[model samples]
Target chain A: MKRNLRIMVIDDENIVGKRLKPALEKEGDIVETFTDARNALERFSEQQFDIVVSDIRMDDIDGLEVLEQVLARSEKTKVIIITGYATVEVAQEALVKGAFDFIAKPFKPNDLRTIIEKAAKELGR
Target chain B: MNITSGEAPIQTDDPQFSHHGLGEEYVEDIALKSRPIISIRFRLFLAFLVIFAFSMIVALWSIYALSEIQVKIRFLEAAGNYLTEIQQARRFEKNFLLYGTNLEDSLEHLRTAESILQKNKDTIEKILGRNSIQGMSLQLNNYHKVLEKVGEAGDTEERNRYEPELREYGGQLVSDATNFVVKEREAVEDALSLSRRVPFYFLGILMVLIIVITSFLVKNILSTLNRFLEYTNRIGEGDFSPILPKRKYRDEFSQLGLAFNHMIRELDKRHKILIESHKLRAVGTLVAGVAHELNNPLNNTMLTAGLLEEDFERLPDEEKLDMVQDIIKETERSKVIVRNLLDFARASDYKIIAMDLENLLEGSIRLVHNRVKLAKIELQMKLTPDLPPVHGDEQALQQVFINLILNAVDALPPRGKITVTDSKSSQAGFIEIKVSDNGPGIPEHILPRIFDPFFTTKVKEKGTGLGLSVSQGFVRRLGGNITVESRVGGGTTFTVLLPTTEVPSSVSAAPSP
Candidate 1:
């Protein structure tokens, strides 16, 4: 029996979190969305997520820091970094820092969901 | 706004008048560039001062030297007169002794000699300072007294006795007179030789002084002039670095240099403003293009989102997801366009690094490949193997090539061919990248203005008309140039000439075993 996947979405834009919450929830995953990176990082520490999708540019804690923190807490957790201002250098840095994948902004929600589904399979769900 | 009757006072608010003002300013700018800031008068003054001083020194020296020679000649003439008087007295004494002529002729000759001797006494005194020639003067008086005694003798015995005495006296007198003449002759010769030698010595000294002074003046003028030349050369090459005059002396050259430095500062300020205004204009044009470009993707996304919403219940989950993906993809497309616009408008600091042309060309081709493919364009790349690295900013140069390629793609018809060729330029130390396309060629009249900003042949939506202009700007900053050649029906070729970095031959030749 496959259990529900745990996903965390962090973006500074309120619409991004609002849109992704319902979209990911429709896929039968327990998705938690945060518009503030600090609040999201607090939520991340309180609970383990199967897949952590984060925006790379944010006030306080960025996606790379979130990735490092998540990986430090749970090595199996997949951290995916998204950015509006993505360059080859930023993408490579995010991946080198233990991100499961790096995707530029305005990406399809399905693109993220596909990565989350892969993370779920890795979790043996 | 309402139009009044024709009889109403004629409105004087013509836009052409404002444009005329702008034309005047532009003409003024041209005049400023053409006219020399340093006045010719200042330079001429410097040159005239040097020449005038040189001529003045030469004139004064010659005058003094000539006058010295004249004074020596006068002295020589006085000595010659004294020598002539001595010769005349001796000749008469010889006539009286040898021919035994009448006493009257003898006495007359004696009297004439006495007066001539007295007349020349002052000249002798002038030569020998009155005391040095007293012995010569006393000898003349003794010869005169002897000749007078010979004339007064009464009988033959008296005459005979006095004659022998007179012969002895005459002999002594002649010998003394000969010595006086020789001494005077030597003095005159000494004066003549000295007068001759002094002028040459003075002239040699004067020449040396003149040469030293003239060279000093010339060196000062030349060094200042050279500095001005170097400064102007730098300005000509578009370097606006301030010139610090080598000397702070308040000379005309220094003042001119100061004025030049001030002008350069002004020019640099004006140049900065011109660049800023140009950037603003480019940004304005880019904003228009960006807004238009963004409209299409935004509209597509909005329509797709609305459809997804309406069909949410009836459509299959896969179809719903596809629609959502379409919206996301459209959004992303708009984002990419905006990013490119911002990158084009952003004023980035220039960085020059050695870059391989092969990789740059491939990257640029890849960027435009999808559009090129969709347009059914045939793309041919003939990049020479191991083309030398050029020094430039990679991203900027990449933008340049991508812009050129896209422009070529835009100009092409269906199934057109774009040939990108790279080779070492015939101009040494440079490499050439040529992008040639076979399409409906640019019009002959329009070709010259192709690289001008905001000048476009395409419909407004197709281009912002900044691509070629921006590319030219980038190429120029990289110490290169972009030029286009087109014939009305014969397609267009854009040639980019870039300076190559001097890579060591050994590095390119072979690797060590």
Candidate 2:
């Protein structure tokens, strides 16, 4: 029997986490979600997550900073950035700063599920 | 040089030519049309020609009149000389007749008088011609013969007879000479009168010529300048009506008029561009405000829709599943509209690259193919093979094409057609792509407002109204232009012109992903 994967979702909007948490949990992964990024980062240091999905824009501690801090804390954690204000520069910036992948908002949950599945496979490897 | 009242003054709407500017500062109160046609160069030339010709005529006439007077004076002197000789001969003849004892002195006087008479006869012949002098010459010869007879007479009676003949001859000679002098004086008077009249005739002809030439020159120069001034005034007032076409003679004024018209055309173009850019700026600000307000709500809807889908297993019924699907679908639609608004409002950090236009068009068509199929709309693509690449952001350009295609799909009824064609533009270094539809066309009244933000004819659920405006913005950012033409019952065509780029060797021939 394989051990369940650990995934964290961070967004300023409450609905984003509320929605993504159950979706990832349904795939037999342990999912932790947060609306406030600072609290998510505090929790992230206490426990290791195999994947971190974060919204780029937030009230405090944007996704890129979260991505850097998470990578600095643990090199193996896959950070996926999501943005409503998606542009080529923002995506490229996120990817260059060690985000595992970048996706625009208003995308399907299945799209995130696929990226998470690939991230999980990489974690197992 | 009087200007007629028939000509109208130039009118213009330009602020520079307003009453406070050109009217008050530059132009005088005199009606421009009523003002005399004044070309300084032509006027000066005419004045110079008239003055020079008049001076020449005056100089010539003075020389001619003075010479005539001199000839007349010479003739009078010649007549006086001949008359004096005739008086001297008469006195000598009378002395010879009265005093026979002083015959030697009388003969001497007679000989001197004969010599003077002979000299005067030649002069009179030269002056009056041979016929008038013939009688005088014969008279003088007869008087000389009579004198000889007096000198040779044996008695006083013979001498007295000869003296009477001599006196008769002398009297006839004096009368003929006096008659000749009087005729010469009359001829001189006639000649002097003719000389005086000649100058007036020449002056009359010259004056007529001067008037004709000056009038012609003044009118020609004045009318041309008047037209130029009128054109300038109209241009200053922002009226862009073309100037009069150039005349056959390509003079300085003609060249100036051509250059002036060219300048006006350029100014008009710049003014139009300035106005359009200002409109764009205003729209940009409005779109930014609206987009920011709409984005969060749209995001929330999308997330909530996702949450519904995530809890789909626990929702308990198929009806709920259908409703969740509807929410997701509707939310996706709203997200597209919000994205379009954001795209229009946001200042894109444009990444320009050499992109194959044919590939871009094909990819865009493929993106909307499913919708086109569902609508039963026929898609026709006629891309020019080996079409040149254009410099633009692929995603932005794709958005423009996708928006156009979707609009075409929306406009069409079942079995309608959408045709997209691309070709090299007739203008150098540019390519033209046309997206056309055979659906019911856009109305004429709303055609001008098609590119305006939030302007749409579609129902609230069907459109966000930002599509065409955002497409136009994207094209403009890529240094291209998009325009549309539609007739009421006829179909609509949207043409986009984009600048071509030189593809670098490193770039692959494959279409952009």
DockQ of all candidate complexes: 0.02, 0.11
TM-score of each: 0.47, 0.43
The local distance difference test score of each candidate is 0.67, 0.70
> On residues B1-513, what C-alpha lDDT tens digit does candidate 1 reach at each position?
111000111224432122222222222133233434444455456656765786677668667766755664664564455445555555665565556565565556556555655766676576656764676567656666766776676555665666666666556655655555576667657756765676677667767866776676678678778878988876654455555534434356645655665566555545445445644654575465456445545544654565566447887988778778877887897887777666555566555667778877876675555457546688999989977778776657776887788788888987799999999999998999999999878888988788765578878766656567657766776678999999877998999999998755412321111
iRMS per model in Å:
11.7, 12.3
- lDDT per residue (tens digit) for residues B285-346 in model 2: 43544443345456556655765666766866874665465567656655654554444434
Compared with the true structure, the alpha-carbon lDDT of candidate 1 equals 0.67
Q: Could you give the interface RMSD of candidate 2 in angstroms? A: 12.3
Q: What lDDT, from 0 to 1, does candidate 2 have?
A: 0.70
Q: lDDT by residue for model 1 over A5-108, one digit each (tens)?
A: 88898876555665677667767888898978888878878898888888776645778888888899999988888865557898999989888887665455
Q: Chain A TM-score of each model, in the order shown?
A: 0.92, 0.95
Angstrom error of the Cα, residue B365, model 2: value is 27
True contacts kept of each: 0.00, 0.28
